[model samples]
Target: MSMQDTLDTASRKLLERAAPGRVDFENLVVVPLFAVVAALILGALTMLATSVEPATIGRSYLALLQGSVGSLAAISETLTAAAPLILAGLGLALGFRAGLFNIGAEGQILMGGMAAVICGFSFSHLPFAVLMPLCVISGGAAGAFYASIAGWLRAATGAHEVITTIMLNMISYRLVDYMLRLPWVQRPGRADPISQSVPPNAELPALLQWLDPNLRLHAGIFLTLLAVVVVYWLLFRTKLGFEFRASGASPEAARYAGMRASLIIVLAMATAGMLAGLAGANQVLGVLGRASPGFSAGIGFDAIAVALLGRSHPVGVLFAGLLFGALEAGGRQMQVDAGVSIDLIGIIQALIIVFIAAPLLVRALFPWGFRRPDSGDGRS
Candidate 1:
């Protein structure tokens, strides 16, 4: 089978397994949980092999737990980090369901954020009620239009989304840099490729600032939650979503069923782009308050792993995003409190993804925990 066909099969299986009374329990919950545990255990082993002291290792782990959930401050940090991740991951998850590997979220984030920043500052006179929504809408629209380029290419010229999206990512990096240099966008007296601050009225209101002004958690979390519900409804309830799934399952069959394959491809890509754009807005409007070089900070790329661990399901993505967020928040404390290298967190994350992708290896390592997917009995 072709690569697209293979991807479609994988996506279909993922969707099937996500359903009630399906393989969802094994693949979605059990496997991801074990993958995380195994990665952590291996991370400890790596520390031991590196001659790190056992006391230090224990302290590092303790610090990690404390930083992630020990207090309200840590929870705020984790939620702040997770907002953009969950937004971006949901978009990518939608694309995956449609058999589109649109990895250009980084680019989409950049362009969308730039657009929202422009809207925020340009319409500074508008009230917060109007301006905030305007900035968000502009961001989503920009992302959708940007992503549609690859979708259009695929529909019109048979260009693969993987190649096109990667190329778009490269182009977007330079494009943002160029835009930042424009006098209108550039901050006064700043030679660096950074933008002027977005207007205060356009910023997403801090959710926890009433309790602590330093809290980064913002109303963006609400937006992220809303997107999750919308995506769930779209993918499982709407006829358009069925069409998207149908196309992914078998393009030929979808065409035979009279679905507009070209339109579906473009719409799917554009929809994913919109979500990514919203993520960009969440970053700029809720957190950064402006644009800069590499402002997205690889959130787009990391979201790919989030989507994978979530099994491309909206609810799954939510939990996965939060888990990754906790890891990030905890990793910082691990470094500061225990003087452990933050790189260990990266190693653990990589190992988790490796284990997630290779479930058979995890099953082999812990045979008692998992049943074979095809087995009716408990035996593998």
Candidate 2:
């Protein structure tokens, strides 16, 4: 054979060897894993820089694991922490798929919780079957209405959702504060701003109370799971979902294809708001039993990270929520057992985001794992 023919044969062999390195499920899984690992290593280094001992770092991580899932009770706590996160993350993920940056979930959640609380207290005499569904629906509706405002502005006035949603969030904080102080909403004879507690009949039943009354895990977990299934089906199998994805991927192209760009935007934002509302409802009816100032506790904000970490996929969001929940639950343990600051968890999370967002860093750190397949001409 001629020299050119030999080179071509060699190129084919090289390409074959590199083919397995192309992006796929294995690469997807490994990339995130590496990101997490890198973040953890950086965290350890940070701890050492702060004069923390290596043994303390080890103990801190062990305590984190123990607090998150060391036993059945710990596992339950992790799940409880994850419940609202999963719901809110799903909402954010849906909005992301539709090309909307819905930063107003925090506001929508507050409105939903307020609506649910009102419904729960106003109809205290209703039967459980009647009241529970009503409360949930009311919360969702309130959230939808709140979110629709941003959507409307985006469609009708060409306002950006990011700006509108942020403004709306600030408005919601004051709104909820004012609402909580109202005589009818506030607990009778109470000086502090707090809403009346949800009636027993309206409260969501604990899912694993039989195992332990201390376990806070509630039926909201089921709700979150059901939402995952519904979202997955809607995004992959339905016509509206197609419109949402299409419009998100390219508004100009979708408009050219005869899709109603405005309508899709409105519907997507409304749906996302409804889901966020349910998360607020879950927190009030299932956990807190009442509303107060800052009741959301930043779950809406954390949900953005969860959605990003999950790649805006429903199933991915579920697992990402769980991971974040573990971090939250474990942070307390790390603080107690190892005398490490719980803020370390936040640092680790931020690092993970940074690493994930910059895949080239990860690729550079582990070149073999991400090496592109060679072309026939030996080009990457």
Candidate 3:
């Protein structure tokens, strides 16, 4: 064979190795696991660099494990934290799959919480069945509306979602702050800028309150699971989902194939906002029972990492959310038991994202693990 022919064959092989049409089981499982391990190893090294004792580093990790799942109560706390992350991550994943970047989930969450609080306090006489659904619906609608503003701009005015959504996030912060201080929304007797508590009927019932009233785990867990299943079905088993995927993969081709790109963009963003709004409702109705400034606690922002680490897959997002939840729940324990700064957890999370984003680096770090079994010679 000519040298040029050999070079062409080598290039084709390299391309095949680097970019598979679909992720194989090995890549799906091994890549994320390896990235997490690499992050942990680097995190340990970072601790050592900061003058933390080796033994203390070990104890901090152990405390993290115990805090996340050591006991039934710890497991419950992990799940509680995971619930909002999963819901919001799923929303962001949906937008990603539709070729849209929605950085406005934080604002949507705030709007949803504000709407739910307003509904909850205004209809104090409604029955549980009526009040609960009303609050949830209001929250979702409010979120959808808020997110649609950015989507409409993207579709109609050619504005980029990243810039628009980021601006929207800042707007939401100021908007919520103003709303909380209003005479009708604020607590009746207190001057604090907090909303009135949700009525009992409007609150989500704790699933395990019978075991212990202090357990904050609630029916929102079931809602989050249901959302995962629904998103999966929507993405893989429907015509609209096919359109979303096609548009994401190639907008020009989807347009040539007669897909309405504008409609899909708006619809996808609206759907994403609705899911994020539900997350806000879950926080307020299921946990806090009222709206306060900064109640979102950066769940919307962390959800971006969750979506990326999950590779925009619904099932992947669910597991990633759980993992992050465990880290968050354990960080407190590590701080208390091992005298380590909780900021270490943030560093680990950042490292994980960096590794996941650099697949080539991960592959280079674990060559033996990523190596594919050779087929018969001359097969190609």
Instruction: Specify the highest-lDDT model's number.
Output: 1
List, residue by residue over 210-249, the lDDT tens digit for candidate 2: 9788989888889889989999999989999999999889
Stretches off by above 4 angstroms in model 1 are: 1-22, 372-380
Question: Candidate 3 regions off by >4 Å?
Answer: 1-22, 372-380
Model 1: lDDT equals: 0.92
Give candidate 1's error at residue 371 in angstroms: 3.1
Cα lDDT tens digits for candidate 3, 1-380: 99977876786577566656433544566788899999999999999999999999999999999999997777888999998889889999999999999998899989988898899999989999999989988998998999989999999999999999999999999998899999999999978789999999998888887998878898889989999999999999999999988999999999999999999999899989998999999899999999999899999999999988888999999999999999998888899899899999999999999998888788889877764433313333
User: Candidate 1 has which clashing residue pairs, if any?
Assistant: none
Native-structure RMSD, model 1: 4.9
The regions of model 2 sitting more than 4 angstroms off are 1-27, 375-380
For candidate 2, what is the TM-score? 0.92
Residue lDDT tens for model 1, 1-380: 99977876776566555554546577889889999999999999999999999999999999999999989999999999998889999999999999898899999998899999999999999999999999999999999999999999999999999999999999999999999999999999999999999999999999888898988899999999999999999999999999988988888999999999999999999999999999999999999999999998999898999999999999999999999999999999999999999999989988998999998888888877865443333222
**Candidate 1 worst ten-residue window by lDDT:** 371-380
Cα-lDDT of candidate 2: 0.88
Highest TM-score model number: 3
Who is ahead in TM-score, 1 or 3?
3
> Which model is ahead, 1 or 3, in terms of lDDT?
1
lDDT against the true structure, each candidate: 0.92, 0.88, 0.89
